[model samples]
Structures are given as structure tokens and as C-alpha cells.
Target: MSKNSIQIFDTTLRDGEQVPGCKLNTEQKLRIAKQLDLLGVDVIEAGFPMSSPGDFKSVEAISKLVKNATVCALTRANKKDIEVAAKALKHAKKPRIHTGIGTSDSHIIHKFNTTREKVIERAIEAVSYAKTFVDDVEFYAEDAGRTDNDFLAKVCEAVIEAGATVLNIPDTTGYCLPNEYGAKIKYLVDHVKGIENVIISCHCHNDLGMATANAIAGIQNGARQIECTINGIGERAGNTALEEVVMILKQHSNMNLDTNVNTKLLNYTSQLVQQSMGMYVQPNKAIVGENAFAHSSGIHQDGVIKNRETYEIINPEDVGVSKSSIILTARSGRAALAYRAKNVGYDLTKIELDVLYPEFLKYADTQKEVNDQDLHQLLSSKDNFKKSVNF
Candidate 1:
């Protein structure tokens, strides 16, 4: 892959499942794993194998099902977790073990009650042990976002020396600003020895609503892998959204960055994960939301009606949406009314539209939106416009 090509590490089945009440069975995991491979993600973080018997089964099933993407299993910095993960991924065509420990001062002092020197030793040991089972070992520094840049660099250098092929620097609590996160990654790139041999990965959370922004910033600073989930679902607020990051790189061609993702399948994949997990995506969420391509405001509706590009940066069809919706609301303009009227088979002239506009507004004001049936009723009430109504 080119240096500009970013690897998409989808953790929808792992971190995304961590959302309360959004657990998936082994069968559901296999289905989603196949779809992730079809969606062209470079790596699929299947699950934390040592967490539960069911999760281990799901990871094993996904490993056997996925044909292309590298199947990765998460593990703590211990021999037992790594061994369990290895056994679960035994059938994988390409398997990866993701292992690490806390590196931040808060975690070192309070969470683990250990010293920085011990944390480094554990990180190196985990990566080295994981390397024995799989050639591809990804080492994460838990809470790396808050870990001192110099200490983080030292840990990264140590892990790389121990055969870590990928370095995941996660904003575990979603604490860092975009600039701060970018600077952290840059500090590692410039400070860590033997860094050129490993891929720098960004795994951000959305607690501060900066996960996607921070991921982009990390990319700008030289990280090449983005760990994300579909619809941005994960612990707390969520992780960086797969569709958001993929589209950002595609939309900003000048960034000279690209991913192997199949953009057309983004909406399909989002819905699939939503249905499988029983999680409802917010109406206004970006990319895959119900309202992403829906226009209701008068000015915006008119602009979108005139030309889709006037309001939409992404083509609805490009993301698997059949078309844009011009929802008829009290805020809708004459252009929007005419456009929707034409779609339901009524081509109203200026005189007919002028006659029907007030009646339509009266009905629209009383309801949230004026559907085709409501439009038909409104047009039928106007004696002069009644003759032009299609139905």
C-alpha cells in the first residue's frame, strides 16, 4: 500500500458491542465479519477473546468466516489473555493479537499502582509474547492520549523492538484536543527509535465529540491506521465512525489520503450493524443517518432542489441512498413544493401553484410534514387546482 493509503481497522464487533445491551451472538458476529471483509476494511478487531466464552466463540467463528481482512483479537498485557486469543484465532487466514497495558500516569499510579518502568516492561513482554503466536502483533498503550509524550514514545519504541507491527495510541477517555492528539503522534514519529518499521494507529473515543476530528488530525501527523466502528457506536459516546473517516479522506482529495473501503456499502453496513445490535442511529447523525440527505428547511430545500451539490457534499447514491428527500414542512418553499408535487405526478403551473400554496401551508402548519396523501388532499381542496391533481 502507498504511504498515503490509510488502513481501516473496524472494531464494530468488539468496542461497538461494548455499548450496553448491544451484544451480538456468534452467528451475528460471523455475518458482520463477512460484511466487513466485503466492505474492504483492512483489519477487523473481532473481539476480546478472553473476556467471555461467547466472545471467544464469536471471534473464532469470525476468524473462520472472514476471507480477506486481518482478523484481530484484543487481549490484556498478560500471557493468559494472549494465549486465549491465539487459540481463538487458530483458523484465521490472517490473525493479529492486540495486547497492551496502561501507560498514563493516572493509570500507572492509581489504576495499576505500578511504576512507569514496570509498565514498560509489561508492554514489551506482552508484545514479544504475542509475536510468538502471530507475526502481526498490535500493541496498544492504554490511555496513551494522556500519557506523557516522552514516556509514550519510549513505550512505543520498546514494543516495536519486541516485534509489535502496529502501535495503537488510543484516547481511552476521549480527553485530548485534535491538536494535542496530533502532536502526541508526531512526538512518537520523531522521537521513537525504529518507528519507521511499525504502523501508527489512532483509536479515539467520542466523549468530547472529537473522535473523528482527532483521528483526522492523527492522520495528518503521520498515523496510517484508523480504528473505528460503524455509526460510531462504542463505549460511552463511541469511537471514530468508519463511514465518517472514510468519507473525509475521500472528500478531501488534497489530503492525499485514501482507504480501501467500499464507500457505496457504508449505508448498508451501518443499517446492518444497527439492526443486528438493535441500536437506533440518531436521525441527524452524519453519513448514515436518516436525515443526512433529507431537506426540510425552505432555503436549504430550494438550494438542494436547484442542484444537490448546492447543499450536499456527498451524493446520496454514493452512500447507497437512492435519492435525496424534499420533505414538505411549514418551512418548505414554493420550489420544494413544486418539486415534491412533480414527484407524486402533479406538474403544477405558476397559477395553479399560487392558488394551492396557501392551502398547502395551512395543512403543513398543522402537521410535522405534508406527505403525498396530504398534498393530494390540499390540492383537491382548491377548486381551481383540483383539476390538475394527478390522483
Candidate 2:
């Protein structure tokens, strides 16, 4: 891996499918998995093999189909789950068994009904057991965002020592602010023994709409891997979006991080997931959204027309948008009106445009937006004008 290259650990099939109405069949999972492999993600978390037979089959099929990316199967920190995940990944060229347990006090006391020492023991034992199946094992500290730093460091150190190749610190409930999440990752990097040997991964949720921010903070602090999904689809308000994080690193080169993702395929991948899962990406969602590069306001359209960089940070083609859209609404300026007119096979001069602008506004006021046909009619009306009589 390059010194500044971040590893994209995509969990779309496992986590993204957890949405209530987004369940996908094994064939759909395989299709998305193939696209993800081409998209250049480092690891594809196929599914939790122990969850059900259908999940196991999805993992197995994805393991067989994916050629470039490592196929990973999720598991609980226990014997049965680890065994099932190993079986599901038996045919993978590069296979990983991702197993972990809850680390936070709330999860330990309420969710597991176990003590802290016992939880740590289970974590170590799970990693050691998983190492027997495959050399690559990822240990997740579920809900580590709220876990005490000292205890979290202890668990990280123990897992790294026990043959785990990756340590995942998840903001399970999206409770931490960016500063807080960065501090947590920094603490683990400073305090955990043998931490430099393993990859530090960040898995964040979007309950507070900060998943992308928190993921960036983690990378800036110390994390090298981001566990994200297409369109940020996942359990409970979704997870960090792969498109947003990748583009953020690309646009803000000052961050000094890069991912292997072929950014041009981002929009295509998002659309595939949306169509397969039957959950539409919100029109205003970031990065791959319909309005992501669309300019409608007069000031914004004028700035974009003059120079796209004035208002748009990233190029539409950079993410497979083909071209930016200048939507003609009541608020659209004359520049946008002319721009759209030229595209529609009309070249109106300033004099003709000045005559047409008022009528355009009047028509725009009566509708939501002015389409090409609408603009054509407005221009045609002027062409049919009769000569003025000077008698």
C-alpha cells in the first residue's frame, strides 16, 4: 500500500442491506460485489455468514465471484460464527474472517451481560481462533466511539498481539463529534502496543449527519481504512458514504490521503445499489445526488457559467455525471438561459435575448421550470413578429 493511500473496506452488502426494505437476493449481492471489485475497494465485507443460510450463500457466491478484492465474512466473537464465516470464505482468493464483540460499557453491561475482563478475553480468543482459518483477520470493537479510551487501547493492543491484522473502531450509534472521534483514534495510536503493525479502521453511522465528517477525522488522525457503503445505505440512518469520503480526499488534497477507488465509477455504483436495493438516493444527497452538480439559483448559475470552479468544487465528470446541469427556474439568470438555448440548437443574440427575457420570466413564473421546448416557443414567437408600420 502507498504511504498516503487509504484502504476502502466496503460493507455495502452486509451493512447496507440491513435497511428495512433494502434486502437483496444472492444474485443481486453478487452483481454489486462484481461492481465493487471493479471500483477498486480493498476489501468487500460480503455478509454475516452465520446469520442465515441465505447470507451464507451470498458470502460464498461473492467469495467465488470477486477476483481483485478480498472477500470478507462477518462473524460474532464465538466459535460457531467464526467457523461458519470460514466455510463461507473457503473459495476466496483473498479471504478474511472479520469477528468482534462489543467494547463499550453499555454494550458490555446491557447487551452482553458480561464483565469487561471477560469481554476482552472473548475478543482475544476470537481473533486467535479466526487466525487458524485465515491469516487476515479483522477485529471490530463495536461501539468503540463511546468506549473508554484506556479500555479501548487495551483491547486494541491485545487483539494486535493475538494475530489480528485489522482493528475496527465503529461509531455504532453516531454519538461522537468529529473532535471526539479523532481523539479516540489518536489515543489508540499512541497508547496501544504494536498498533503500527495493524490497520486502524473507522466505521461510522449517520444518525447525526456527521458520518462522513467523522470518517475524515479518523483518517486525519491515524486510521487508514474506512468501512463505508454505497449511497451511505446501512442500519439506522445509514453508514459513511464511500463516494463522499473518496471525493473529499480527492478535492482536499491537503488531507494527504488517497483511495484506490476509480472515482468515475462512483455514480454508476451508487445507481446500481439504488436499483438493486430499491432504495432511491435522495435527490439532495451528497456526491452522487441528482442536484449535486445542478445549478438553479441566478447567482450560482452565473458563477458556474463564468467559471465552474467559482461555485462547484468537483467536476461532474469526475464522478461519472457526464455534464453539469443548468436548470432553468424562475431564479435562473440570463447567462443560463442563453447557455441552455445554445445547447438546444438556438443561438440568440443580445438584442433578441433582451426581447425574450421578460417573456421568459413571465412564462417561468407560471411554471416550475423552463424546458428546451418552452425556450423554443419563446424564441419562435419573436421570429414571427411583423414589421412595424411607419405610416
Candidate 3:
């Protein structure tokens, strides 16, 4: 409820690790936790303790080393889960136990086979139990996106009274559109009692490709905390990419929200997570993607060559990316070709260049890229490059 700061709760090691084959070892999780601390996240949901012994160890190890952020452990709405989550987070300078239950009728009926009143009761009991071990208790309404508005408000009110310091509204299935998600947060803001005293958070997935949009929308609707992951890795499509959401709040004045993340560490942290998961980042992935700054078009490459800002809204350096890359390809313009050639110490006359371009095209097609060494060899040989000088 603080008007001055927006909290970023990074769930990369917890919910993100739930993605198939994305599980990280304790050392890896600790490495990520250290990085997250440096990145300045308000909280790091280290892992779900009851999932496995490995996960419990990860949460415990991370809890020991995390200094700047509140080290948190996730739990279900049960005492055993809350106790395990508490033990895993016992070593933290600041610890938070994030406990929750499903609130939607669909989840209550199909998932838990319980009634709405029982769902609210379980949520209150979970928070009350978690508060026994940690002063910071965050309660989530799993599948809140599909829950009835009035029932969701009622759940939030009851949980706040039960000592929940933060209320996380998760779009577990990523079913809400941006506007709908925003309205959900706004509704809670208006209706939930003591909502101003407890932090409101967003946990959106990318099933409909709107996770980040929904997260931003939640911010606009007065939610101060965003629960997201690196590269959007999660259960299904993924959660909101923390990099995108942080930068969105940073670069856009319309959403004057701000997070504690050090934008410079984003790319490295992303790579760490990717490497730990044994998955490569898609080339076109935003922010940390290999092609995020790679330009293949003629006009765009030319502009990027002259001024990166002309083609890129974000400075590559802001996300630990070095600079824009002017990649020469079939679509590359003369300016890019010339610039690249010059980097390798070639200064061909327009007339000479016109003759050699054919060979360049042939080589370029065979390889993914044209390098300086190949260009040098072709230009050095007068036998291939020379012609009747007529320009």
C-alpha cells in the first residue's frame, strides 16, 4: 500500500522452476538468489518446500544467503506445507511465507471439491499458520483471474484479517485480457477492506500471450507488486517475463511505477536461468534474446549502423546487452555491407564493389553470416576482384 515504491517479487526459482525440465539445483537456485538480491527484487520466492527435498534444500540455502530481498517459500493451504515452507525460510534476514488456496468456483469444485466458504476458511487458516513463523505472510488466491469478483473481494478481506501482509491475485491460467486483469485489481482496491495496508500483487501467466500486459495493467489498477519470472518460464506458456515488466514500468511515464531491479543485470540473470534449465533462449526472445538487437533488414540496419536509437527503443546496454548488431544478410543494404567491409579493412571503390557483390551474395547464402576473414580473402585476390577499370 506504499505509494512511494512498487515491489518486484521474482518467482523464477519457485513457480518458474515448475516448468517441465526447468528445475534448478540448490546451487543454481542459490546463484540465482544472489543475483536476484543484487538485482534488487523486493522478494525472491525461492521454491516450494513441500514439492521435494531438493526444493526444500534450495529454499533453505537461498534463505541463508539472500540479504537484500525477503527470501520467501511457497506453500499450499495446509499446516504441513506451511511448516515446511517456514523451515526452508528460517535462515533469512527477512522471511516471507506465501501460502494460498484456489478461490474460483471452477477450482473449488473441480480441483479441491470444496465449497467457496471452505476455500475462504482454508485461506485464512493458511495465513494464520504461516504468520506463526514469519511476520511477512503473503496469501494468494490461485486462479483468481476466473473467480467471481465479489467472492474474490471477500477472500481478500478475510485473508487480510487473518494476518496476510500481501495478497497475490494470480491469473493461474492467464485467462484475463489486459483490461479485465486491470479491472480485477481495481475492484480489489475498491472493495477489499484494509487493502491499503496490505500489498496487492499480480501473478499472471502468458497462456494468451498477455502476461506482461496483464502485469502492467495490474500496476495501473493500483497493484504495487508484480510476481514474475525470468524469460517468462513457468507451468504452461510461462509467467510474465520480469525483464519486460520491469522495463515497461521504467520506460513508460504513463505508468509511473518503478521496481528495485538493476536493469543492467537482466541479461546475465536470464542466461543463468536458461543455462540452469538446459534450454536455449529463443533467438527472437525479447530483452535477453540473441536477436533482440540483431538487425537483418537493409534500411533498419543502415539506420542502426548510424544510430542505434533510430531503430531500438531500449538501449542494449540497459539490459546488459552490448549494442545493436548490424548483421549482413540478403536483406542487408549497401551501407551495411560497406560498413562491415570497412571493419575488416576493405575500402572498395563503388565500381569494384559492384563486381564483388555477386560473390559476396553467393558466400552469404551458403553461410548464416559473412565474416571478415572470408571477405578479406576474396578482396585480396586481384584475380577474382579485378576487372577493366571503367567507373
Evaluated with lDDT, which candidate comes out highest? 1
| Model 3 clashing residue pairs (backbone) | none
Per-model CA lDDT versus the true structure: 0.94, 0.93, 0.87
Candidate 1's C-alpha runs over 4 A off are 388-391
| Candidate 2's TM-score | 0.97
Candidate 3 on 1-391: residue-level lDDT in tens? 3584789999988888887887777877888889889998999999888999998888888888988899888888999999998888888999999999998989999999989989988988899889899899999999999999999999999999999999999999999999999999999999998998999999999999999999889988888899999888888899999999888877885655677789999999989888888877799998889999999898998888888889898999999988788787877777787888777766667877787777778777888777777777667765644453221
TM-score of each: 0.99, 0.97, 0.94
Cα lDDT of candidate 2 equals 0.93
User: Model 3, which residues run further than 4 Å from truth?
Assistant: 1-4, 348-352, 382-391
> Cα miss at 61, model 1 (Å)?
0.7
Q: Against the true structure, whose TM-score is highest?
A: 1
Question: What is the lDDT, from 0 to 100, of the residue 308 in candidate 1?
Answer: 94
Q: lDDT tens string, model 1, 1-391?
A: 6898999999999999999999899888888999999999999999999999999999999889989999999999999999999999999999999999999999999999999999999998999999999999999999999999989988999999999999999999999999999999999999999988899999999999999999999999999999999999999999999999999999999999999999999999999999999998999999999999999999999898888999999998988899999999999989999998888778999988887788789888899989999877777677676566555
